[model samples]
Target: MSAIEASPAQQATVRMAARALGRAGLVHAYGHCSLRLNHDYLLVCAPMPPGLIQREAGVVVPIRGELPDGVLGEVRIHQQIYARRNDVGAVARSMPPSVMSLSTAGITPVPRHGPGTYFAPSAPLWDDVQLVRSTPQAEGVAETLGHARAVVMRGNGAVVVGATLEEAVAFTWFLEDAARVECAIRAMRLENASAMSAEDAARRATTAGRVIERMWDYLSAGDLELNSSHA
Candidate 1:
């Protein structure tokens, strides 16, 4: 059991990520997010109804095990990712409609905006459409993901990883935006939907760290607004 308990601040970040991603339509009742507590254990959003996730809702789940009550079965996804990537501190499994739609097709999102540049060089598309349930399946996903910030699961959605919960959560939205823009452009049948040049993308990539931080702040505020609206 590699999973361990999360600190109070880490738990708060996990909850915020869930609500922010849900409010942004990047995830729903079916999807989930997680934060690595260390090299072993992870804190994941326990299975629950849709909407905002509060601090108390995060579950400390092991990398491999009989899951605790409320923990999603797909936890292996996070476990395998963390096991494979020493640099990853957070992971998100979101199913945004646009990202899902684009995943099933041959289209790949390029740097179309500042947010899109977070993926910089490019994003990988995982051809498998099957759910990541078992350890082997999750391991497969990690392989496909490689060093990419995110990977589109064919006929599924996407898996995003980052060095922080904030970055990972921001990536969920940024990746969705990229997919949405690509889909919109495809719909228009643009003759020249030019992607950002490598030089420009490289320049933008240099600012990705700060960009994700700001995006996290902005999205967390949006999550608060959604909370207030529901109040």
Candidate 2:
């Protein structure tokens, strides 16, 4: 697949998404986000902490080939995922504190709240603590994600996907909030706390009424780069 150049607007959006994840505390010094340019290529944030990426244009890499020099090793996760999931147009690698803590105990957040419903019954657990730096490992993680919106890596972090970059960022926040609810319930020893029924979750898991757009606005509200652009 031939690489495509990411426009300045696309680069800005990717940077803003990275900053949003960092500002929301969903990621710290080890996370990334990418926007799919098409089936053949994606534009990933610079090889730095997502929060600190400013004025740096993203790297455009082919979805099916070896990662270009200067791309992070873990970016292979994005590569394999884009290769497998055509519906996904963006991907976020985040490590929300609550989500991370819960996954260490082999638990993925259950849909106990409205935000949780976006993940439906629950986010799948990848059950691995290792970083996804190898082709086979990345493929395995993407396979575990399946058609789900997110996947929790055991004691590592998570991967969230969406039809757009903004939606992916919003889902990262939603996943963290769901984890927060689950952690609170478990901490209170609420063994009887009921998770949303499958039917109920299906009903509640919607993007109606600008739910995702509102979140994206909130997260990107103060982003100077994004605010300065008309894209």
> Model 2: C-alpha RMSD to truth?
1.3
Please provide, for model 2 over 115-197, each residue's C-alpha lDDT reduced to its tens digit, 9 standing for 90 to 100. 99999888999998988889999999999999999999999989999999999999999999999999999899998899999
Highest-scoring model, TM-score:
2
Model 1, TM vs. native: 0.87
For model 1, name the residue pairs that clash: 2-40, 2-41, 3-41, 4-41
Show the colliding residue pairs in model 2.
none
Q: Write the per-residue lDDT of candidate 1 for residues 40-142, one digit (tens) a residue.
A: 5788876763345664557887765556665666777788888889899999898888888887884558898766787866678878877877778877888
TM-score of each: 0.87, 0.97
lDDT of 2 at 77: 91
Every model's Cα RMSD, please?
Answer: 3.8, 1.3
